[model samples]
Target: MGVIVDEQVLTCSIPPARFFKAFFVDSNNLFPKILPTVFKSIEYTEGNGGPGSIKLLSFQEGSGADVMKHRIEEMDEANLVYKFKIIEGPKMGVLDFESVSSVNKVEGAADGGCILKSVVTYNTKGDNQNAIQETIKKAKEGFVGFFQATVGHLQSNPDAYN
Candidate 1:
């Protein structure tokens, strides 16, 4: 019915502390500031963004990802990583699938900027093989844009994000 998808070494370059904010921003004031349209708003219906929290993220336009609701299945601030399972919005059905967005590395460069490698894996529900494939491809492009935009954002406001 479904299949698991994986992406390895998906890389991007961003200013130092940019990726840190991705994982550290307060759920209430994070996405809108860093990634506006990509993350329109987040409502923490349950806990306060820690593990086991529930959130609804509204995406603007049709930026490939659209929008969805997710539950924080796992989180590690120290390691700067988190895993959340998609609970609603575009999965295919009720409890259709899940995803993991993990930051493999957040390191600084001697010259400037940071190299960020992230792995985003997905598993689709039964009989949704085609959708799973499409989703994986979109994830790749989205990551590239995300990296470039993040870097541009920091570079534009130097003092704010660097």
Candidate 2:
């Protein structure tokens, strides 16, 4: 299988602890509420919300993809790090990818804000370099959208995820 890796970094004004709590720890509840048009729901299909757990994220109608299943590989709450692997998804089938995994880390910045660093690895089935790149582009865009929405929500609702 051909492997492709992509790295991204995003800087936000929110503090690392707050951002991590809202975006990572509480995403299953916050995402659907914030992006109702895009996300239908996020629920655990197996185990609790921890390592070895399986999460199923269902998208709303006309959202291009129906649902995605992810397995939590690691979760370091104290260090604000999370890792997960996409076990099933329409995107994987359409793009001919064998597997997709990501590691997200949030760190405190000098200005009291936070920086989010993400590393995504894609395992492809064949020599579809172009397709893999396109998928990576879309994934980056999606991450930005989600990040912005979460930031907005946390900014507006000060009590959220406290």
Model 2 agreement with the true structure over 37-142: per-residue lDDT tens digits: 9899999999888999999999999976899999999888899999999999975775579899999999999998999999999888877677667778888999
lDDT of 1 at 46: 90
Candidate 1 lDDT by residue in tens digits, 44-136: 889888888888877878764576777776666555555666667765355446444333455566655555556555555656556666666
What overall lDDT goes with each candidate model? 0.61, 0.90
lDDT value, candidate 1, whole model: 0.61
**Model 2 / residue 117 / CA error / Å:** 0.3
Q: Identify the leading candidate in terms of TM-score.
A: 2
User: What C-alpha root-mean-square deviation, in Å, does candidate 2 show against the real structure?
Assistant: 1.3
> Candidate 2 at residue 128, lDDT?
69
After superposition, which runs of candidate 1 have C-alpha atoms over 4 Å from their true positions? 8-18, 23-30, 33-39, 61-66, 94-105, 108-112
